[model samples]
Structure formats: structure tokens, C-alpha cells
Target chain A: MPFVSIRLAGTATKDQKSAIVADVTQSLVTRLGKNPAAVQIVIEEVSPENYGAGGQLLADRDAPKPQEDAHAESSQ
Target chain B: MPFVSIRLAGTATKDQKSAIVADVTQSLVTRLGKNPAAVQIVIEEVSPENYGAGGQLLADRDAPKPQEDAHAESSQ
Candidate 1:
């Protein structure tokens, strides 16, 4: 059995998910000559809070800087 | 640190998830001598509609058979 796991930093629409499953299945079929029937794929949408990259959580990395927020407030 | 990702075809209960995390953590610790605290496990559940097998979506494969439905309707 060929199992594929995809972890996304954020969510995807149902259409996107469907397309991904189809594409991955096709790729495996083309490359390995594997049966599409035996290919299994799981798409995981991970929240930034739970995903870490570059030694820090994605949420912290992507969050607006405090100074930037203060600047915006001051400008307003 | 060892990271493990598990994909399930359907949903799991909280107790099942907790047990799985604990079991996997222990396995890494026993086999690889990795620290339990450093072991990170992510469990992903995929709906049948988003999963494909036998060259078709699982949802489609498991759907009610047209012949069965027709027989039921005729009997009714």
C-alpha cells in the first residue's frame, strides 16, 4: 500500500483537497506504475499554533509585531 | 527528537488518540532511546469523501449500491 501524507500550514477548500488527491494519485500511477486503487492520501491542515518551523512556532513567526501594531495605533 | 505522523482513514476517539500518542512515544523511547518529552506525534484523520482507494473515492466506493436501492424501492 502506498500512503501519502501532506501537512499544510493552513486550511484548504474542499475543491482543493479533491484536486490534490487526484493529482497525487496520478503522479504515483505515472511514476511507479502503481495502481491508483492502492494509493492512499491524507491531507492535514495544521493550525499555525500547532506547527513549528525554523525553531519557532508558525503562529509566532506570522503574528504581527507588537511594534507594528503600536505604530498603526499611533498613526490612527 | 523524533517526530511521528499517523494518518487514520476515519475519526478516532480522544481516549484512542491519547493511547496512541503514549504508545508511540514509548516505542521511540524504548527502541531509539529518545526522550519521551522530545517525541512529538501528530495524528490526522481523513474523511472518506477526501480519501481515495480502488481508483475511486472511498465515499463513492462505500456509497449505497444503486441496485440495492432500486430493489428496496421496488419492494416498498
Candidate 2:
């Protein structure tokens, strides 16, 4: 089985996480030709003080942006 | 939306990815309380030769094993 591990850094709204999981799973089913029943998705939430970027923790950065931009590329 | 990006190293069987996506998505909805529709999962497949481990490319590893072991832990 192609077990996909998604290490999401930064806190996300409950609804937001759900939306991500559902659509992402669908993408895998259609784009990769995987069965909808076997797909696995993992979402981890990290604190701004915990995740770092550009050499600084997100909490320390002037703009503590989450890594949501990676998926900002809408497949829609 | 929380965009979950899963970079899968090595080719995966169609059944495997499907199982992983489905189960994982359920876990997120149950554990993180995210909406199924809003969640977005992306699985990028990499050739075994394209992935690396312990400083050696998977294609060059003496064992040449895929990184699917990370999710070997079954939450089922």
C-alpha cells in the first residue's frame, strides 16, 4: 500500500483540516488512480514557535505564515 | 484550508495508495475534526532511484527499500 505521510506544520482550524483531508484524498484517488477506500492521510499540527522557516521559527518571523501555500495551487 | 502534501518515495501499488488515502482521511476527520470536503491531500510519487536514505539514494541503497515504512504503523 502507498502509505502517504503528511507532516503539516502549524495549527489549522478543525474545519480547515477536514477540508484538506477530504479533497487531498480525492486528488490521490483521481490523479494517482488509487482506490478511494485504501488511501491514508496524516495531518500534524505544529505551533508557530515549533515550526521554523527561512532560518527562524514561524512565531519569531515577522510574518508567521503556515506552509499552506504548498497546496495553494488549486487543482480546481 | 490545510493542504496536506504527501511526498511518497518509490512507486506504490494502486491498491496501496488507495487504502492509505481513505483510511488516513478518516483518521483526520475523526481525530482532528476537519471537514472531509475541505481537506486536500496530495501524493507525489517518486522513483525508488529518486529517493534516498542514510545518505544513499534508494536506487543506490544496498537494500533499495521504499520509504513506506514510515506509515507501517497501522492505526487500525
Q: Identify the leading candidate in terms of DockQ.
A: 1
* Top candidate, metric TM-score: 1
B6-72 per-residue lDDT for model 2 (tens digits): 6765666777667656765675676567576755667678776777666778668656355576456
Tens digits of per-residue lDDT for model 1 on B6-70?
87777999999999999999989999899899998998787876676655557666877789888
What are the DockQ scores of the candidates, in order?
A: 0.41, 0.12
In model 1, pairs of residues that clash are A37-B54, A37-B55
Please identify model 1 stretches exceeding 4 Å from their true place.
Answer: A5-23, A44-76, B67-76
Question: What TM-score does chain B alone reach in each candidate, compared with the true chain B?
Answer: 0.82, 0.69
- Model 2 DockQ reads 0.12
TM-score (all chains, Cα) for each model? 0.60, 0.44
- State candidate 2's TM-score: 0.44
Residue range A1-76, candidate 1, lDDT tens digits: 7988788998887677777888889999999999888888777788999999999999999997799888989999
